[model samples]
Target: MYFSIEPKTSKEDLFNFDEPYAALKKCIGLNEERLVVVFGLRRTGKTSLMKVVYNELDMPKIYIDAREIFPLTPLSTNQYLVSIFIEFARKYDIIKAILEHVSAVEFVLRAEGKEREAILSSILKNINAEMQKRKTHLVIFIDEAQLLKPTGADRLLAYIYDNLKHIQIVVAGSEIGILEEFAGQNKNASLFGRAKKQITLNRLRPEQSFLFLKKGFAQAKKQISEKELMAAITEIDGIVGWLSMYGWHYLKIGSKKALETIVKDGSKIIADELEAFLSYRGEARRRYLIMLRTLSIREMRWNELKRTLELEEKKKINDSHISNYIEALVNYGFIEKEGINYKLADPLLKRGLDFVKI
Candidate 1:
């Protein structure tokens, strides 16, 4: 089970995060209705932690991986909500007719904003009432919640939080793209001023990282020395997902190049996701790539990044431009700032960024 690399759902699959597991239980138990935001960098187990909470709680739940969702297009925010709900209903086997008129509500009707929210609100109320009749609470868990387009999502979710007594939505997302800002922390964003519970996952400690690999190999009935496990911890720097990838290939192909294979394979995965974020940036792609490539090897100061960009562009770049670019990357969880230095947040992504060749 530990050898499995997909977003884990069962308790038996995840390795660590005792603190976060407890925190999640308390949040759902204490708050009758509240927004709980769980976030971390890519490959850091935010999704797995969400699954642990989803499975632990005694409730009716719906889990959506927002990464599988694309951004909004040719629709109002309410339409986005309707579309996502439609997807949810289809995936979870929620009786379509129990949704009442949801199937009948056409896309044309959703564009009329007020009526659409009313429709959605009514469906949620019905679902909540059913949940109460069954003596179970409703938890709507959206993992990779950052990938959701902000537009009308917060306002609609805010409505559900306020109007439904038996239903609550808990969202988990990576820092990869706009997740931090979309989370209603912005005064202008919907769900603003409402109290929120946030739990951020950090990388595994050195000892825990070694144990994770040790236990994973043991589960596979493979023999790997403690020294080899420690060497891996040092090489990969304690990211659980990346470590799992290395362990997966190492088990399949017992050679030194398995390490190189992880890097090559990881870059393709991280780069594909990164490129999706980059696509929405328009003409600013060059500048962002420059910054990411530079930070791959060294931490940088704000001004230093600006000067480098200006020299490369052969044109004057303003403070706001540089700041905005970095802010976007930070929001998505691709880059992080500590003190005055800025650097890529994921070690595997840093290795992958080298191949990005900005």
Candidate 2:
């Protein structure tokens, strides 16, 4: 079960993070006032934690992955809202009436601008009224919520948090910087100054990773040597996703082939993600790549990295420019700072870098 590479919905399949699991469960069960935000590196089990808590709690709730309904236009944005509204109605056992009203209004394909806003607001108000009548609460769990930024759905979340007394919102995202921005960690945003509870998932330690792999393999009814386990731990570090992948693959092939497959497959996935990240960062993409490539070789202090960047570019890049680049990388969870040095947050990103073209 541990080696099953899916977002775990059962606590038994989860490994460690007992404190986070307990805290999150209590927060939702008690209907905490503050919004709950779960943050972590991409494969550090944020989804698993969120889903596990959602499944354990007995409440009126709906979990939506914003990535699936990412909107491309105003019409699509309204459609997304209607989708959420319909899901909420279904969860509350009001879908029959809600669909009747939705069809009568023809809001799906026609609603736009203020009309869409009004319809969404009305839907939430109605849902809140139903919850009040039933003397219950509704929790909206959104995964990868940063994807909703451009759709202006954060403002909708802000409205729900402020007006609906019986509704609680929980969101999880791997992109820490963007997720914070979406949640109005910035000064000028809808959710600005709003109270929030945050839970961050970090990579496992060496011992934890070893035990995780050992236990996972045992559950699979296979045996692995300590030396082989140590090698996998050393290479994959502490990312649970990679550890699970290794364990799952080792059952079919041997250790060497599994590691190689991880590097090959994982790098491709990370490469596609890095490419997407860079697509939004105009002209400065090359500079970011140079910095990442330099750090990929080894960790470096500020001055050392700056000198390397300047040398590679054959031009004197300003201190502020270097600082911004490094800050962006750190914020995006691509790199981490220790003492006075910076390095890739995941070792696999180095192999990913090989696939990235300049």
What is the per-residue lDDT of model 1 for residues 1-358, given as tens digits with 9 covering 90 to 100? Answer: 7766676777788888778887887877344546888877878888888887787776567777765545444244445556656665555456553566565457435446566667767667667666666666677888766556444666767777777767777887776446655667777767777777888888888988988888889988999877777767777777888888888888998636667787788878888778888877878987899888888879999998998889988999878889999998888778889899998777777766655544
RMSD in Å for all candidates:
3.4, 1.9
lDDT of each: 0.74, 0.84
Evaluated at residue 254, the lDDT of candidate 2 is 81
TM-score of each: 0.86, 0.94
Q: What lDDT does model 1 reach? A: 0.74
Error of 2 at 235 (Å): 1.1
lDDT of 2 by residue, 1-358 (tens): 8886677888998999798898788788354555899988889999999888888778788888877774455567668767777777986687765555576347546766887787777777878778778888788899998878888888888998888977889999988888898888988778988998888898999999999999998898898899999998888799999888888888878888998888789888888888988988888999999999999889999999899989988999999998988888877788888898899988889999998887
Looking at model 1, report the run of 10 residues with the lowest lDDT sum: 69-78
**Prediction 2 TM-score vs. true:** 0.94
